[model samples]
Target chain A: MVQIPNTPAPTKSPAPRPVPTSADVARLAGVSRATVSYVLNNTSAVRISEPTRRRVHEAAKELGYVPHAAARTLRAGHSRMVLMPTLPVPAGPLYSQFVHDFQGALSRLDYTVVQYGATGLRGDDAARAWAELRPVAVLVPSPGIGPEGVAVLKRSGARAVVTLSPVAVEGARALLLDHADVGQSAAAHLYARGRRRIGVVVPEEPGMEVFSAPRLAGAREAVHGTDATVTELSLAYTEESAAALAARWRGLGLDAVFAYNDEYAMLLMRALQDEGLRIPEDVAVIGADDLMLGRLLRPRLSTVRIALPSGRDLASLVDRAVRNPAAAPESQERFVATVVHRDSS
Target chain B: MVQIPNTPAPTKSPAPRPVPTSADVARLAGVSRATVSYVLNNTSAVRISEPTRRRVHEAAKELGYVPHAAARTLRAGHSRMVLMPTLPVPAGPLYSQFVHDFQGALSRLDYTVVQYGATGLRGDDAARAWAELRPVAVLVPSPGIGPEGVAVLKRSGARAVVTLSPVAVEGARALLLDHADVGQSAAAHLYARGRRRIGVVVPEEPGMEVFSAPRLAGAREAVHGTDATVTELSLAYTEESAAALAARWRGLGLDAVFAYNDEYAMLLMRALQDEGLRIPEDVAVIGADDLMLGRLLRPRLSTVRIALPSGRDLASLVDRAVRNPAAAPESQERFVATVVHRDSS
Candidate 1:
């Protein structure tokens, strides 16, 4: 067995060979192309002979013909893509976690999460661009898209048109995250702590205005008719800007503040400290989006805890829409926002 | 324009209309489907009359038909999805910004970024699952994939196989990010500061081990036959864990530590401060990924700044690979990692 005939050992290139398809499987199985498709897809309606089914499976296995998701999607007149229009803001941990979980759930349900850059797209034009991809579903931001855009998406065969807001779109399912609740909860928490002169720091960044505007409005609404007063403060995310605001802290005379989110709260906290304002005595602060870093603060920052729907629930909803196609629009359910009072407030 | 008294105003539903195809445009233009496609796509190889091109454009515009990306991909026997197997770790700001720019670049180039959830998948099975989507390109993790998996993807129509590491994989392009450089840089920075005893933090998390192991190896290699000593420390992302490590910090006799990344560094920094440790006096610390929050810390954090390729460059490379499949593998160019000194270290 040691020394045989003089022959060269065979080698295989790393370059991949052409893959087998359903057509190849059908030819090998001695069946029609329709039969191959039916067997592979397990078409529940059409009955196939047990022997024919076995042959199709056997041939598919021998040729390594996995029914391609894209090809199958084409046959079904849809794309497997679930387009998530990227939000303008750089996603922090909370949003990142939500997306991560959602991705996991969708993957388990067999859908690809395609994050589309919609920063430059607006309204129907954005919808048109999105439609070009022929995505089966789209998770669009409510602020950037409206009824016309939704119509465009629907026309392009998007089965599930879900909006990222608490108010339901005319013909799409709403994920229903009410930012007002975040502001309201933070303001209410500060009020309960006996801080009446409240200040809401509205971020001056371009993309953040969508969130900051509603938050400020909600805070103002929460304080109306009450002893508390809600004042809006404009702030940018630079140290110089924070320092400038801190320098004029005494002139504003706000006792309590609802910073937009934890990041802003942290920024303002350092600034206020640099201005020599004592917490609770001079100013009390509460931020939304309860982040882990907030816990590491000296006085431990108080925050508004956001409760989002689990990935499994959202994924099931998308899958249902994809499967059922059309159904009566369900009423929007508000996500919960509760106050977590740490020493900062 | 005023509305007519007798005529009812039109309403648009969110549901989209069926998209028009090349055949529809051809019928209206009184031209062949091939002529319509060539004219619409601006196929330079085929010459057409100016009147014919104008007719095709007018017909397409009148019908409100834009050439669908999916239909074209189907014609080309490929999917526009560039599958990115998601990492197990929660995305920090560094990863988020990188992905954001990458997505923007890809979208501008008319490619979709499909972030596939591979937490539940491993090895060849994961590749098979990814292949089902028939992504034109794949950015796979080094540890999770192998040569067979790369082969599977190529066979399934994935035009480019790229790894996250700089080290080349069989038949795949690697996006060179060497963890050794990150470790060496951090350790070298600490050594230059005259800190002989250094502690390297290895996060006690499931997904983080892949990074932590290499970092530890790199640190060990950097200190080999040197006067400096590198000690390994296990830390979880919990307040209690950080406090426990801080409690033993005094006994460990370590003057400097290179925490895995910014998140861990921030967490440990707070714990150390709480335990009455003075920055740079009792112990100095450094982390990687120059996140925005690190700049906000009281004694501002020092970090390892990773300079990744511009998204435009990376996207064009991917597009080039998709366009030309049989090209030779390009030489690996290491991503630059440099130390950024601040108050902490």
Candidate 2:
């Protein structure tokens, strides 16, 4: 074992006095502890006169009383929470932006968003770990967990389990978002633009197989369905990787490339330009996830636009499911994907 | 008084008994309640041997013993948590990505990240509202909360307060990252590329002034130090805003624009291209936060590379502060900014 260096001792004293409790507020308001609880929680049942409610509110205000989240969770069974398990991915711009929007939308509905860190866990273990907190719902982005995992979560009282994967689980509601559609849509648009040869970007990341495989499959599906021939190109999301890919662009003889998304498209586009390849004239490029900056390019890059199901819709579904655990599973919904054509394609 | 309509009630009976608690785990493990708590919490004072620990762990695992969060909070006196109060402005891709990374880093150190819904609170009131939970720290984005707010939190037992503002609060350790530096760095690079009449993007969203103001200030500061002048152009993230801004590109007579970041830069770039503007020649564009897709543009976008302090460094600092609250306030640390030159500029 490595010997640890001695650290300086801390000098700070313990904080002054304990935090004021709801009992203090109840005493000050001259009401039963239950009455204070009901007034403070704004519960609809067990009516108190307006003035009495005002008295409890005033006492709470004077004492700086905020309901304890932990105590509330204990009484309420589960938190008014939605947990999204996050993995570190090279999300680039568009996907990152969508996540930001999703968070803001969830906040508007008074639901707390908890991003559970599940870095090393996989499958049923990951699901069981997540279910430990008793979240109302779990939104898994390309879930590594399977049917057994879903069963574990359901048994633990997770009302709704939504995965952004094409494959549906036995016990959970699946949001079957076909990533293949994004890749297919990009390829189809490029093919229609009269490009015979296409390069599909394959990200060189271990976990991206979850996203990249489906996208590649979709691109191949589109290419095989048409006269266009598709070539797979493995590229890591790095300056060096993009430069190397650009250096070999001439040898590949591809007329156009679907660079996965706006980030990869921009990366390769710059490298190709550095290699003296004029976009559209020498090569046409398309990206997916119509990011905000795609249009800012010299020749605006064409991209695939994916619309997420509205936050209101998802939140309402979660609320309903939590209230009635035996309710029938909601039908799987697939969000629409469309193409936004610009100059590069 | 408005009469409320009766809602359809649940048709099926509720599930048997509540989620198994710590008491249940104790019974399953055939251990005393104190022994179970000691093993589960890994309390060092208790000399429970390895076999005893294993037995307790297995029993808790078999019974699915998730500590009731509320009960734990009540017993612990304070939460093992941090609260981040977000403004109404959408946390675009770059900031959102940083936040995600920050959360990951914090989780590694055993801190639970809670994004509080602070929309209805402001200033000192926001601090009071957050203090109700007795979190260990509060991280407010730059320009979101003020000094009085920080003081309120300190009085409420928040040991550490971190903010992204240029100004440091009296008691909090400020991670002073200047947003203006981002725009100035981008503008300086654009000017070096012989582009004149720079356009600075100003987001039209109600709450974006916090970010946009600093960026514009930085751009103007750089331009004022030279012969060029920055034209502040208001653009929202919406398509309509981009189209309108793009349509009047020629009227502004700007040869280059410093977009706030990759997202807005991409939005305006697309709009400009749609309106038939030649990138670099007609209107060179530069964005901040060197996103992966910037290079994928027809002419790669030049950007300001913001060098944020490592998450490990920040977390370690926070932990130290928590352990020693009376330690002299850490001197404000400022991160450096540099320009990443690409084809667009």
Pick the lDDT winner: 1
TM-score of each: 0.84, 0.85
Assess chain B of each prediction and give its TM-score: 0.82, 0.85
The superposed Cα distance between candidate 2 and the true structure at residue B97, in angstroms, equals: 3.7
Distance (Å) between predicted and true CA of A102, model 2? 4.0
True contacts kept of each: 0.49, 0.29
lDDT of each: 0.82, 0.75
List of chain A TM-scores, every candidate: 0.82, 0.87
Residue A122, model 2: lDDT of 76
lDDT of 2 by residue, B204-322 (tens): 77877776788889888887867888888988888898898887777778899988887678777777878888887788898888876665655777888887777567767777877
Docking class of 1: acceptable
Give the DockQ (2 decimals) of all models: 0.30, 0.34
Residues A1-345 of candidate 1 have per-residue lDDT tens digits of: 786667755443355677888889989999999999999888989999999999999998777676677567667778777887777677878878888888788877877777666346677677777777778888775466777677767666788888777467777888777888788888888888888989999998877877788788888888789988988899998888888988998898889989899988888888899889987578898888888889987778999998877767887888888776667556566588999989998
lDDT of 2 at B161: 84
